[model samples]
Target: MTDPVDLFVIGGGVNGAGIARDAAGRGLSVILCEKDDLAQGTSSRSGKLVHGGLRYLEYYEFRLVREALIEREVLLNAAPHIIWPMRFVLPHSPDDRPAWLVRLGLFFYDHLGGRRKLPGTRTLDLRRDPEGAPIKDAYSKGFEYSDCWVDDARLVVLNAVDAAARGAEVLTRTACVSARRDGGLWRIEMRDGATGAMRTVTARALVNAAGPWVTDIIGRVTGTNSARNVRLVKGSHLIVQKFWDGPQAYLVQNTDKRVIFINPYEDDKALIGTTDIPYDGAPEKVVADEDEIAYLLAAVNRYFKVQLRSDDVLESFSGVRPLYDDGQGNPSAVTRDYVFDLDTGGGGEGGDGAPLLNVFGGKITTFRKLAEHALDRLGGRFPAMGNAWTSGAPLPGGDLPGADVPAFLNTLRTEYPWLPRKLAGHYTRLYGTRTREILGNAADLGDLGRQFGPLLFEAEAKFLRRTEWATCAEDVLRRRTKHALHMTKAERAAFADWFDNAAASHRREAAS
Candidate 1:
């Protein structure tokens, strides 16, 4: 056991990491523990867009949509490299939704949260616009609107990185086995997944940001209960070779009234998802079943002229959304908005022992605001905590000149003339201002060390292992970077083999 810190956070997803970053910046001692890698769960499995849920207007979710719209710009400015503006082409159908309704939603989406940098909505004639080239002739009208794309897993890691830089302990592969209120602090016991080593700490407060397993954390880990609950809605996505020619993505409405996003992914592929079925199994065991795959493919086949087959699916993943249960029957209708349940240790509203703040539901777009609001709720507990500062602050490598990627790329190529445009572009998109950390003084491709895949190199792998706590090959391939998507199966196997040997050799060296 150690001296009591100000806060102990469970779960290392985006919400947990965001809260830890906020608290550490405020001078509060914090410990953020994760069972797996940083964003191995739902955080990494999102649709990978910082969107304002434009369809939510029909559900009368004005406040949620507005808040998310505002956050879209905030995140764009904060991390312009990974989070850049993308225009989504919605091929309209008379059967799905009225054009006027769609127009009104787009209008509200434009002005709802204060649009500044991104472009507003525009009508596109499918017969004339290049964006509609792939669409079927039946849909002659479409609406193009703006939303920001994100590197979801990286977003979580960056928050954790900033938090650690501000003096917070980040424990990956560490599970909080128990958290109990003792005296005025909450004692936390964690077990390492790799070595089964045990450690303990105490904190004045505990936060349950465990997304899908939040209830489990409350009932099993912390030995408590809340009046609220999370509805497990499984959303699945499919990865296929990019069939479209443009930089734009497609948002097609199914006959069922659900929308599926066909976003351009990994430069040469499309990420199409997501089915909203009620989930009842363990979150860890979730997978994209055949039915869900068929559903997604059918949605794509409805609008696009290119007919996609089951064999076209390169990869598929499913994530269970732990949405706040508001007694809604439809899984899609269940609120994407978040709710905080603060248990003041039975001392009533303001009264308290060691306060336990349980975060219920949240989306990727509004994670920062969620963190701010979470800290605000615990303001009374930590009277000495500093003011909120993440609003204007840039994430670790997000301090670009006017948030211009093309400009940054130009400067980078000028500095390292030998670096290939594609390689330089990869490093810039992923690492942003910190690309130098990977490049070092390397003059050419040979200096970058062994090539694992087209984009992967020995130097970049070493850098991730050294700084980003990347233990397994999947950590580097799937989550930290999407190199796995580009590599052949045999290539991925070879890379994983190399990773294991390298890691084992390092361990032996340390032991020696």
Candidate 2:
């Protein structure tokens, strides 16, 4: 029999990948199994902001707000390539929230987290400042605060990469079918989603970071009962052509007191979204319904001078937030905080059985802290493990000197003088220090191989496949990168066909 590993994590979302990285860095042998692609669920489909959750202040979730606010700078320093500061313009509406109340909330948001690098809040004259150009003239007052934007899917993949680099096994597109506790250890059976191959491993501890599927894993996969439950709250977003000028994003208040974010996305497009509604369906099947789209458009039109319609929406996505159910009647009122349920034994007395740590309810901003707290919960189980270190460590491709993105971008332009300015910016923003790996030996654009679309080349695709665990065209187009948004329908289809044929040929050659 093989030796038992220290930790076995189930899920590939931000939280799961974060935990795996933390555990692996702490010198514990770990294996992470995800049923699908990394961050294919709720993690990638978030508001994509690392903010303090200003609305939660009304609900008195001070702790969550404080931690998240602090995390913004922490993540910014760690991965400056993919995460950076963005100012948000919150147009004050007398009917929704009083100006004084909004100011008070911003005050708490500014001071709650010991903020340093991000600028503090300042009042805005909506009629005068350029940020108010898109806002209706009626809104004369506004508040501008700072938050950070993130590529949520890439964040998960980078953590997985770092974990793998630290000697942990990250298995994507693999499902953990069954986990049973045997002789004070967890025997887990996992099947590959692609090949139907099955494998088993034993671990001293198990972590369930399945996001929306947390309860399903506990109830169906592990057959264990938990006193806690996850509340399913559906949130949706829309991608449309960029309607506003400037890099600043808008945060508009709806009549129901909900806030909608209209942020600039992909340079030429806008990302708007997020409605809170109680969901009772499968997480995987969640999609933006017509009502949700109308609701988002209506909310944006209500505040902005530039009206938006359903036709403006180029793409849309929805995800179910598996919040820790606090019995809140309103789905929006549910806590964004996380809760840890530590089952020290498999229905055994005392400490005679293996440990199973079930994580519930966390946001992207606080994933690192969540991972630290998770390991803290297992301190008793792994006393010899290393101390917490992720806060100061950079993820893969994020080690830009001084965490300065613009400086690094300039360096990239100087080094790759033959590269187009837009292409250089894309590579610098996405890959940071690792751009050289994709640009290797290529003196000009032609060396990048076949050009599938604007900015995307065969060399980048090959690099993604070789290094980032990209297995399919969708993995490259949708998750690993946002090339799908730039490519036409025919272009995307052609690329998919080419990728399929090339991958098949490579596999056959390798086998022979």
Candidate 3:
């Protein structure tokens, strides 16, 4: 059967979802297929920042630095609820780079891209400044710079949601198993991972955006070859209770010339991470090894007065970055910029044919621009498509009056006075203007239905299922929300059981 879509995108990571959203908005019929749930890959497992690679200044990545730096504020305005400006405290290590160089980098970072709303960098006297209280007394000097924090997984979901809202099809738990050029169109077969069912789709073009699985999709799934290669760099993060005061994050420079981020997470906890190690194994089986965790904890312990121990680790996760192999031997030195390989039908398709664009190596901060550039790469195919419109558009509920989130939160506090303070704040921070849709006409706590745990109320679960396409309990607890991190093990199990039964019963009723 002939396919109806103009584009068939493989993967539901940020890059795929963003591309699908951009293409769909440009008047192209699009269908995005993910092997697992949205952000069940590296997209969710990021450092969760939208910053210009501050350290990349050393590598002379001026282009990447400027683009990403500009994207920081653009994304903050686009999704105020999921992305926000953050200040980072970098304690001076005279043993490492000199203070003059650090100041120079910070100066470039401050003025690189039109930074209008976010604050500029400032030097600190660690011995006197309140920001230096948490650091060890050994360090008496530091610098503070600005970046933006992001809900990485939610960023993917918002793109997919906006794509769907613009009439694009987003099929989670669907894997593109095969692709072949048939006539001028591309034939793609997708398998539903949950049901063992298969379906075929036809599209004018196909996009490979499987992140760590990009090369896998190109060779194993698409049965095509490219001169380019993907280097799988394994990175990991550890979560623990917040050990420091204030909202400011810490960027600690390692003796290895690498930097580790210690950022506040989920209100009461801190998110620390990332070791760059080359990996030859499967991406799905990647996990944080003892050495990696020890390394991270050691890095933090080196800078902070309060040393982090193995016992402090509440959780940990690992991801493989599908970096485009530029023949760089060092994993840390590999380029983070993406490369697009378009196959215009040279092999078994006879001579010339439909385009197959394969995206490689990108960061969460640059996904939007990456998507726009991906479409620009396909400009030859669809010259009639609309111009770039995403730079100014808000994602989902980010369209607050004047983009003023503080004012909006104040208004929400007055409107939902009956709601518990923590719960109300959580809803305001996560849902933004869409909080009303979830709360609806609820009068009190009783109107919210059964409360499974501290914050996993039935009302929120129902909203997730109905609006966010959350079918499984883990999707709601882990990705759609962070309730799993806060909920007890027993609480999580009970909520899982409740969600499973509710979904099954609802489906049964719908069929009847």
Candidate 4:
């Protein structure tokens, strides 16, 4: 019989990946299994902001707001290439929320988290300020505040990469079918989704960070019941051609008291989102309905001078938030704070029994702290585990000098003078100090192999497959990188065909 590992993590979203990395760095043996691609679930479908939930302050969730606000800077420092500061311009609507009340919320947002690098909020004159240029002339006041933006999907992949580097096994497209406690350990059975092959492992502890599938995992997979429930709230976003100018994003209030964000996306597009409706359908099947799209467009049309119709939408996506049910009837009011349920198999102090930790309700902004707290909860079981160290640690390729991205970009341009300006910028932004790994010994564009699209190259795809666990074309085009957004439909289809053939040949070679 094989010896039991220290921790077995289920799910590949931010929380699960974060926990796996944290535990592995703490010198604990760990295995993480994801039923699908990393961040294919809610992690990648987020609003993509690392702000302190300014709206949560109105609900008096001071604690959650403060923690998220502090995390903004921590994450920015850790991965300056993928995460950076952005200013949000909130157009004041006196009918929805008073200016003084909005001012009060901004004050708390600025001061609550010991904010440093990010600038504080400033009042804007809608009639004069450039930020207010897109707003209707009827609006005369606005507020611009600081927040951070993130490449959400890449964050999960980087965490998994860091975990693997620290000696944790990361199995993507693998499902944990069953977990049973045997002889004070968990006998976990997992099946590969690609191949009909099953494998088993014994673990001293189990962690359920399955996001939307949290309850399903606990009841069906682990064969255990939890009193806590996950409230599935669906939020949707629309990708349209960017209508407004400037690097700043716009936040407008709606008649229903909800707020809508029109943010810049992919350099030439806009990402407008998000409705909080109670969802009962399968989490994976969630999509933006006609009403939600109309609602978002209406909200934007009310604030901005430019009118957007349904035809303007180029793409849309949705995700289900598995919030910890706090008996809140309104989906919007549900807490984003995470809760942990520890089951010690009815064992008392110092007893010989395995532990199961089920995580519920967390956001990308607080994932690092959530992992630290989760590990701290298990400190009693693993007395020899290393102390917390991730706060100061850099993930994968984030080790730029002083976390200065522009300086690093300049250095990359100097070294790779043969690369195109746009391609160089793309590599520098996406890979940071690790761009060299993809560039390798390539002296020019011809050495980088086939060009699938404008910015999609053979070397980048090969690097993702070899190092980042990319198996399918969608994994590379959609999640690993946003190259699909740039490529035309025909171009994407051609790339997919080429990628599949290449992957099959590589697999055949390995089999021999």
Candidate 5:
């Protein structure tokens, strides 16, 4: 066992990592444990957009939409490299929401939450505008709005990195087998996935930000009960080649009244998704079904001149959103807003017992705020804890001058003339100013070690494993970085083989 800390966070997703970072920065001791790699779950498998959820306005979630809209600019200012503005062209459908209603929503979207830095919504002429060229002429009008694109997986990793830098213990591939309250402190037991070794930790309070497994942690792990419940909603997406010519993305309303986003992804590809379905299966076992794939393709086909078929789906992924059950029957109707269930001793905040904070239904755009609110709930326990500090601070590597990505990229290239333009661009997008840490003093491409693909290099892999807690090949290929999406099957297999060997050798050396 070890000395008791101020907080113990159970999940390593965005919310959990964000909470860990926030608490640690507040002068509170914290330990954050994850069963798998950071963002190995729903955090990585998102539509990769940080938006205000324009459709939510129809549900009268003005507070949620306004908060999200405000956060959109805050996050973009915070992480300019990974989170930057993107234009979305919404092709109007006469059959669905009327043009007047659409215009009203855009008006509210522009004015709500004090919009700043991003362009306001504009009307598009589908018959003449360049953005509408890809649309079938049947739709003669559309609207364009601004939102931000994000590297969903990298966002989670950066939070974990910042938490560690702030003196918080981040354990990846380590599962919290059990956590129970004992004598006013919570005793937590964790088992390492690789060694099967168990370690005990005691914390003054616990946070169950377990995402899909929130209830599991409450009942099965902590042996406690809660009145709250989470409704599992499955959302799926498909990846295809960028079929049109433009930086702008497309938003089309389907016959079912749900909006589909077809966004430009990875320069040469497109990311189209997300089907909302009531999910009852295991969150880990979730996968995009054929029906969902067809549905997404059909939605795109309805507006675009380019015909998309099921075969055009290069990849598909699904994430089970643990939405707070709001007595809504439709999966899409469920509120994306978050809720907190704090369990202090005897159901009161002033009690001296260790508190367990359970987070429900939070999205990427509002993670920072969620963390601040979560900590505020436990202010009675720690009077000496510092005030909320994440809103003004930049995340790891997010401290760019003027939050300018283009200028930073140019500067990086000027400093390292040997770095290829594409490689430099990738490094800047993923690591921002921290690209120096990955490149080091080595002056040329040869110094980057072996080249796995155009973007995947041996030095970058080592950096991830060393600093970012990358345990296996997928951690780098899929989450910490997205080199897997660009490489061939054989190349991926070869890299995996090399990575496994390297990891085994490192283990042997450590044991010696």
Candidate 6:
């Protein structure tokens, strides 16, 4: 007999994981299935900002901007470990946008939404301020504004973890081959990628939060059609060594009016990004092209004193944004707002009344609110479910006293004095209170099992597998942690070999 559940969520991106966490917390029996690793899609490939898209304000999307702005602080307070305040330096360019106009926009940006915790915008004298020291002398004035940065991958994992803690079943490396409605419930068949094993399950409701694969899952996988279409807009980012001092990030406007973000990253690197190009290619094939790289570098070089050459690029990655097709001509002009296509269509050839909720075009900044809206769309069917609870609740270890991260860090260090300050900081930033669980009774560095690379111990890897649903080496290094960027290629290869062997042993033990 197939196992039964109240909610079955397809995809493990931020949206899917967020929905699973919300649904499970609301007393629903949930199962979340991912074809690959969690956040392996566009969720992990975002600009990593939890801010209102300042450009979206120009389109008169005040509603989206306001909601996103409010969400910035909500998310920051909810996940203080992975989310923090960032100040963006927007250098003035007389040719591109007038100072008064920029200031007007900044004025509205400051006052348009609920501004509680984050600081407001401030003007900077480029010639006098240190932020302007890196900029070309051609720029005279700028504005520094507040926003929040996010660990995009860890956000997905934390959502999944919260879901699991609330009794949701998370199945990674599992693909939903087919889903058919059987009366009032869904009969789903999932195939395990590792073992070639198949499992049948039943669900009362199905959620199509597959992001890039939304239409694919709706049409090809579920044998259903949607009136709405997902337009794929590809965005790319490049990682390089930190060339400038200070924690503040740069938001430079290009001659073409596109803005590029140069943000602080990984304690010693700078992250620069994002070109919007129409992408017809599959999401998996999305990569940062040479032209895109050149465009990004040129955008940075236009404002900064340092001429950024292509050789300075350490790594580059791209993601396909599954934007809802609104017939916008320019990919950059495409709306970042989301839409829900609920089809209560005749269920899977059997004519059962099963509804499919299709999610299209959402940003990382408003995932929690998005999940709440998704659940509300289907709330009439499940009136017995609880009311909204996410806004006030903390995400996992985010419940640090008074939400003061420094105090929590101090306490954490006091508990683990043997841990290096840098390593302890990394742990506090990544895992928060759960760092204690990973360190569990370990007295010193030697107790951490195996030393794979800088700041990556086997204990943390095992904790990721056991608690965070990490299954492979890349899942551990790139998504669950950023150890891969710090490790040498040889070290990465060795770690991959060790992880494979360890995973094999773990699977064997689980089966036995």
**Backbone clash count, each prediction separately:** 0, 0, 1, 0, 0, 0
User: In model 4, which runs have C-alpha deviations exceeding 4 angstroms?
Assistant: 348-352
> What is each predicted model's overall lDDT from 0 to 1?
0.94, 0.92, 0.90, 0.92, 0.92, 0.90
**Model 2 Cα lDDT, one tens digit per residue, 51-115:** 88999999999989999988888999999999989999999999988999999999999999999
Task: Tell me the spans in candidate 3 whose CA falls farther than 4 Å from its real position.
Answer: 347-352
Task: Give the total clashing residue pairs for model 3.
Answer: 1
Instruction: Please give, for residues 80-148, the per-residue lDDT of candidate 4 as tens digits.
Output: 888989999999988999999999999999999999999999999999999999899999999999998
Residue pairs in collision within model 4:
none
- On lDDT, the leading prediction is 1
| Tens digit per residue, CA lDDT, model 1, 317-415 | 999899999999999999999999999788765867899999999999999999999999999998988999999988978998988989999999999
**TM-score of candidate 1 versus the correct structure, residues matched by position:** 0.99
* TM-scores for the candidates: 0.99, 0.98, 0.98, 0.99, 0.99, 0.98
TM-score of 6: 0.98
lDDT of 6: 0.90
Write down the RMSD of all candidates, one decimal each.
Answer: 1.0, 1.2, 1.6, 1.1, 0.8, 1.8
* Deviation of model 6 at 316, angstroms: 0.4
Deviation in angstroms for 81 in model 5?
Answer: 1.2
Q: 281-389 in candidate 6: lDDT tens per residue? A: 8898899999999999999988888888998999999999998888889887778889998767654323347777889988898889999999998776577888888
- CA shift at 133, candidate 4, in angstroms? 0.9
Q: Flag regions of model 2 displaced more than 4 Å.
A: 346-350
